[model samples]
Target: MMEELEKLMEEAASLAGIYSQEWTNRNPSDPGMTILENLSALHLVQRESAAQVTEHARISLLKLAGFVPLEPENARLAVELAQKGPFSFPRHQKFYVNNVCFETEEEVRAMQGRLLGVYVKGQDEFREIKELKEGVPMNARPFGSEPLTGDEVYFLFDELPCGRKVGVQLYAEVKTSGTRNPFSEEEPVDFARMRWSCLTSCGYEDIVCQDETHGFLQSGKIILWIDTDRLVKEQVGARKGYMLCCRIVETAYDRAPELVAVHGPLFSLIQRDTQSFSMSFGGREDIRIQPVFPEENFFFVYVREQGCGDYIRYAEHAGPGSEEVQGRYYEKRLMEDGRLQICFLDRQRRYLPAEEENAVIVICCNREMMLHREMGVLGGWENQKFDLPPGGCADAKVLCIGVRYAKAEGSTCCTFFRPGTEKRDGVFYTYEEDSGQICIHDAGPYTGCNIFLSDYALSVWDAGNIRFGNVLTSAGGNAGVRVRNPVRGRKGRAKESFQDIRKRFLQDMMQPVLAVTEKDYKELALQTPGLCIRKVSAYFEEKRNQICVAVMAGTEAAFPRLPLLYRRQIERYLDKRKILTAKVSIKDPTYIRVDVYVTVSVIDREKWDIKKVRQEIAEELDDRRNEREIGQIISFDSLSGRIRACPGTGHILELKTIPAGVPGRFIRPGTDIPIPPDAACYPGDIVIREE
Candidate 1:
């Protein structure tokens, strides 16, 4: 601004010389020069004000370029209910930590039954299995080493929830080979392959309700809506109680499921609140309702005319014709103070009865809601501006700003264009998210025209990431029930800020929407929404015009394979982005199993714990397994150095890789293993010995 002011003074002096040279008393004490300086100072202040762009304006500019700020996400947590007997927990039951509220997503019935014994049928005999407790996970394969048709696993519970829905939680041992891809949309269970039944007085009866375990290919909860009124007491492996049996109707499993433990009555929790109210409006006027607790997370607002039996649709802009007002829709926007206001169509497009009509408003609280209000009447002037949050509405993020006005034909039109852009049959304006100001331009013909804030949304930012153990009390009136979150809340996010969105705008624009090259295919596969992908490799088969994309999951398990369901999702995601001539094939990379053996000499036998050293070496090898990529070369020459770096190791006496050099084999001990172009190496086994 100072630079511009100085430039202006120089230009003024040059102009004064062109007119006359007698008034060239350029001293600072001259009256004319003093007035010029004052005007320049005022000009500098105006320029400074113009240069400061507000947050709403920045976000609006980004939107003009097709970039939108993300909305706030609610956090989620898994809660445990500690109670006795069969207590039913209804969905949306509120739990809280002072002011922060968490609600249940599903109904869970607490079971009073205790798992007294576990049994597996073998050669026509029921054997007692004591491997259901902690520290005995790997040894407990509930369906035996090789599960076959007709094999049964029995769970004896001492008590039962009579005639109610019971929740059964299954914890699978981590040593299993299969992985659960959280992003996979394969939710339908293969009910034909498995059968879950309970022993009743009339014999076995089907009791399966909902099975989230996917036939035990992963760890999940199973819900059983059972009738325990006629449940029979069955004797299984020295225990006489009600038996819940899981039998294999058909042998179909990636790996026989191993059970670490089985418990019941698990529930899911989310950070949100829900409320509804009634409001009335008449004569086609604007309506404003201030919430009592404004700081709570507000997600959605639904308005319905009383006795209409349907919700009035929320539209972003007014329709081009007056008939659209009869579509039963309402617009929401933000006032100057940032509070949400609901607005209706103008008298030209819509008319209400003289008597007030009732409208029901349902509020879904996750910290965001629609807001609309009349900005003010516009005058035929240059740079007409209206401030949004003149006093209140602090820390509120405004999502979008739309305007509507009446045309010369007495019909209404709406637009989202900035000033000087081709008018889309409506008014033009710019908004600032930071200052909550809306500036109108090019309003010469529309003097006295009413400017309505047609659309906008507000959200609270980043205050929902509560810590574990923070939720301690139940807000709902369920006595004898205590809730605790075992894991910290996650996925809660604040709305994206103006500066943050700007930094990624160029990079996002540069990303290719169509998969035309190998790099494009790899990037698209890695960006498949909801999937945790560790690595991706794209290979183009020129002859067939097929791009084969191999994906690796972001998991630390012993073995990770791309499930058929996940592969289908990836294929569909890429299919929408590929060219007409290109064919996409989603596949899993081949794996090379490498076993390691080492013998080490310790400096002090008393100080060295060989078991701990071996465990550390195993962990290092696991890290290597996770970091390997397709066609990567594996070398054993660095094995000795890595083992020696472990504490309690003095020297490596012998080191060898499996299949490299056996008793009569010609292979060398520390040979570099060359992998195939489509294969990745994974750790198979590690055997450590002390010399």
Candidate 2:
């Protein structure tokens, strides 16, 4: 019976659930009815339904309550729960809406205030918003709702509007709502009072203050004036007090009071048509004082010394027309070896015999200064009324005077004067024309004997001037001095210089040999006039197969006597013909012969016409040979296969041939005989037939 009753209950509950879902889908205009119906369906099925049915029911409930479900699968139930109340859900109950096709709970909350017309006031309007503090809702009550109840108010964000202007108006209305009395209404509580309270709480007491000083403090405007002198002082202190003095000029006194007041006190002023000023300060002895002025200020100042009284007195006494103080003079006899023998006289005119013969006799004048040069006296009396001796050295030589002057009122007075160059006799005189005072300058010439004097004098005189005067002698001879003469033998024997005998010999002998050809020898001989052949020798041993040709009587005929330089030319020619060892020999009485060994090479050529080659070689040989009618050749004898030559008598000659196969046939015994067919055998080889 109990099982049947349970089945009947379950059937009824299922029917109620299906009816609820149908009602929810049908009521489109009734959002509350639709949400309640969906919730009832969820309550009927507890944990036994599929997840899809649960999700669809929750999404329908949220959408009915104005909660947008972006991820309906994940956020549908969360959006519905968030739209239900302000209470937060458990962590397990809160669904992760990221994977669902529904808006998140945060989105639902964002729509909660937006859908409810809630607005938040920004920081700018918060200063004027007397009722609102940080984290407090702008709208706590409905429009025209009851006045605020307590000192602190808790408000849900959904109670306010969303727009900024609507939020501001709502905030102002809420702040002023309590001003009307619930019993007897006085004027609304002053808005300024609320503002002051807010500002004071924000720690902006000065911002709310009505006092003028407080207004100035919060005004946000600043005024500044620079103290230029103080600034300069500060800079000076920072840089340790070094300052550059400034130059200032006042063009108009009325315009520049600072310059006009300080004129002659801090700085001096000179009134003139010009716009320049010159500064002169400190004593004349102070060298630190510098003059400062514009370029146009042309002026001069007389610098005076304080302790120059003694100098002035001495100067006055030393000037012109004072007195002719006699100078000390003496003559001493000196020997050639530089020994002083005797002093002739003293100023007293008494003979002073030498206590020490070599002693130097120094004569010092009575006056402090003495006249040595003639110009010293004449240069001092330019305008002074002084008498000079007529026959003095000053009359013989010209004098130059240098004078320094000082302006007195509009006139000039000579302050100092001196003679320039000393006279020929070496005397100097100086004077002061204004004082008529005379001084006898030093009588002795400035010798520069002392080291101190030499250095001081060099500083005063230039090197060129000292050199011109011969005061400073050169350490070596002058560059312009002619120490060398180019002309030969004029000043001394020319043999001391090296003679170019080799070059001269080459020019005289080799030059002719190089210029003439073999065929021109006879013509050259005729042109040489008076040609005489003396003696000729083949220098085979001494000069290694060169011919020593000797001729007589004429310079042109002296071919055999030609120098080695010319012999080299003939050797070069013979070398070209492969007759390097041929030597021309001459016996006296005008007979000559050329000795050589004929190599097998000369006989082996296709053009080996021995007659033609021999003629050509003989022609070259005869060209260099001295003039001699008889010529002979001691050569290898091809006919007899021996070395032989022609022997000449006074007119007739006989042929001398050395036999073949005989030891020492042509050469003397122990001499080397050239081997035939050996390339090393030159023309002058001594050929002895092989045994």
Candidate 3:
């Protein structure tokens, strides 16, 4: 700036010299020199003003190029509340830990209703869990040996809990512990999907609140919000009650899910704080309310004007004439220091607040708040964009977004906002997920009216991952229930900022969407929705011109066999991405079992734990299966070394590896076992003896 100012002053003085010979005073003490410096500074300011782009302009340019910002995400935690006896709780019940609050996601009525019985509906027979347990163990397969699409697991409850909601939890003898890729930065996707239906008078109507079981692939819980008022009590073989049937809608299980028991009336909780306060609004056009909490955790903000029975609505854009259809709406502006200001409509827009009453303002900080409304006015600019208030991060989930527009004041003529870039006369906007901005376009007849966001959701990004025992007391402990997170919270993530979005947007432009090569097909299969896969191998058969994709269901399975549903899911995912010329087929890899027998002398009998050594050998082989890649060779030398490396290991007397079920056929001591291209290998059995 200094250099530019000096150059500008010099140019002005030279031009003056050419115009007037008497103007020879150009030194610092001369009054004319000071005037030249001031003019030069003004020129530099004008030049900067012309060249710089405002934030709104940058957002608009990005919107025109199809890049909008993203909203923040709230962290989720599974909370368990314990009481001495049976208890019931409604959704959104708050529990506090160090001033931070966590609310229940669904209503839970714990131990209120007894689980009468559990039955598996077969083609013609209904097998009761108790009857099935007579000869076998406690383990039960409620969906039968091979669960089909129409197969159902019937859970009979003695009486429906208040609110007709049942949080059914399935406990399995074999718990599934999935191991994720340590190097992966991408969020882990659920590989489990199940459909739960309640027996209503009209028949089985789908009612699923939440399922943490990963489609019954593991031992978790499923919450079903049933309409008991319309539920029909039907007899299943011998017993009858309010039956909740879990139908197999779509599955990717390697085998049938086993269960030890079915429990219920449990719900997940999220961290958030809700507050309600009142503010004075005496016909003022702009009213600012600063919340006690940080603006970043802001989830929902609502205001009810004085004497108005209903809360004033919030719109993204509202101009001269837009109040009748949208109804008493207000706008919110985010300040530079992250404070929220509530902006009301002017007298021209028909906003009249009663002088006697105080306006009620309710705000929810943290977690998901539905129907979060914000009002604004469309400036009629091409590709105009509006930012969500302070809490709107790059990963905020927008379930539904629509603009409410009213053309004339008190006029009932208004239209709903559609999503897209189509040139239509009505209001249309597109949600830029990465940028967290809404861009409005083609408002030919609705310009200068109120543009309102009727429905949206806000979350706190990664703040909800609270520690265990963080919540020591319930906000309102009327039921005398104690609460604590038994396990550490997870799945909470920080908000994706706009800077991250731009970087991702650029990187995405260069990322391949289609799966062309063998590796691409493998990756596509690995990313199949609802399934945490271990390994995938795609190989092209030269003669058949067909690409064979073999998938190994992650180590959660005892004997992994890609079921028909999983195979179909992988096939469908790859089919959409693969070229038309390429032939893609999804198949389960052949599983091979290897048995080992070892006899060794212990160096120190007192220090060696025989049982621990045996267990360590078994675990070593299992770990090898998890780490091994497709077509990777299992060396006999490596296996022996692994065994020898065990603690308190002495000299090995003899070691032999045998193919399971193949007697007398043993691989020579030093030879490596060759794995087939489309096969997965795991240890079958191991026998250790002292020499």
lDDT against the true structure, per candidate, is 0.59, 0.24, 0.59
The window of 10 residues in a row where model 2 has the poorest summed lDDT is: 451-460
lDDT of 3: 0.59
Error of 3 at 323 (Å): 31
Candidate 3 lDDT, 1-691, residue by residue in tens: 8888878888998898888889998888999889888888998999999899776676677677677765444555554444443555544556666655666555556434445677876567766778334234467667666666766777776555554454454332333435322212233333345677888778888885566566565544566666566777877766678887777766544556667555443346665543321223544335554433222334233344454443443443445553433445555677764345665554364554444434433333332332234457777877888875445443323233334443334423333444674645666677666577877766666677666543344445566566654544654423235665544555566645556656777877655568988778877777666565788888888888899988887644566667665666677667778899888777877766777788988887777677776765665455235577665666667677777777778988887776544334335676775656676666677789975
Model 2, span 464-498: residue lDDT tens: 11110011110111111111111111011111111
Each model's Cα RMSD: 13.7, 66.7, 14.3
Name the top TM-score candidate. 1
The worst-scoring run of ten residues by lDDT in candidate 3 lies at: 179-188
10 residues in a row with least lDDT, candidate 1: 391-400
Candidate 2 residues lying further than 4 Å off, grouped into runs, are 1-590, 593-606, 609-612, 616-691
